[model samples]
Target: MKSRKGVRAAVTLAAAALGALAFDGTASAAPLPPGGGSWDHVWKGSSGDFTIYVKEYGDVVSICDTKADGKTPTVWVGPGNGHTTQYWFTAPGGKGACNTKSSSDGAKYRLKRGQKYTVTGCAWGCNTWDFRDRH
Candidate 1:
């Protein structure tokens, strides 16, 4: 009877240890931005494809992109650990007439007469890029 009790206590301790390990990583869960809106769009780069998701932290907009299959997207902020692509403001990059202001970089991602912003994640990489307001 004494041995049986010891075995049961050991098993319970092991189970508790495992549970603690599982919950250890939960603290880093991605912080959800206001309005529950994500600005992630699938993009197909020359090397591969990825998805860009935008969100807000405090007063800044963040952008994060992950590879569609294998390759990781090079974000201006950091690794695409599911939440490393957050941005605050956007300055005009590429050349185009923008209809909507990008919340990620605060720049207008629009279309230009002789310029083009390589937009990814649209019908296999062949779509005219334009910034559309989120509804």
Candidate 2:
């Protein structure tokens, strides 16, 4: 009986640890800038080198390179409906080259409202975040 209880306790502890790790791996939206306009959602890269902002009622998505680490910041956006195609957006990166680029900047693509999209940011590595269009 004592051995069984010990095994049960160990299993419970392992499960709890895994739950915590899973929660940590999930990314949450970042706070918007002061007077930066209404944004449906925003996310900062895991490496703190870039930011992704969804705005204009989810009709536009913007990628900004926030750091001057000599590495370009890129974002991949795709439909959340299990679609396989993804569009890439990137910002100019270099020392003193913090800039923002958007999907609508060059008429690349337009996002639809009320649609879910998967966004991934790449700098040192790649991290993914999800955004849903909101009016």
Candidate 3:
């Protein structure tokens, strides 16, 4: 009887584990705020370096770079790990936007409505540029 109960408990635990794994496949929104995307792949431009960062405690979006150091100090413009500051907005078509409040200026990172920009080691305007997915 003791052996049977032990086996039953093990089976129950296994079933619960499988159930949890099953729910893992459910679709969910990005953990980051709107306009946030993985910046693992970066695009360099003539303007400067642009990185996608989160904004406003996951409320808004912004892009930052050393190219615009004159406008504001570049903060919250690095790779994000799903932080509230790293979340971004993905448009209906997969395009996304990001913003940050850590910068000295208030400009946010935005995806150009109809234009596409190249990512290079150099700097570019995040407000007028759309980050192309490297994935």
Best by lDDT: 2
CA displacement after TM-score superposition, residue 75 of candidate 1 (Å): 5.2
Task: List the candidate 2 regions with Cα displacement exceeding 4 Å.
Answer: 1-35, 56-58, 81-83, 95-108
lDDT of 2 by residue, 26-98 (tens): 3533223323554555666666776666554325556666565788877676667324435675767442233
Q: Candidate 1: which stretches are off by over 4 Å?
A: 1-25, 31-35, 38-51, 54-62, 65-108, 112-117, 120-135
Q: All models: lDDT?
A: 0.22, 0.49, 0.25
Which of the numbered candidates is closest to the native, going by highest TM-score?
2
Worst lDDT run of 10 residues, candidate 3, spans 11-20
- Record all residue pairs in model 2 with backbone atoms less than 3 Å apart, i.e. clashing: none
32: Cα error in model 1, Å: 5.9
Tens-digit per-residue lDDT, 1-135, candidate 1: 112111101100000000001111444322222233433332223322322333212112222222233322332321122133222222122111011123233333211222212222221231112222222
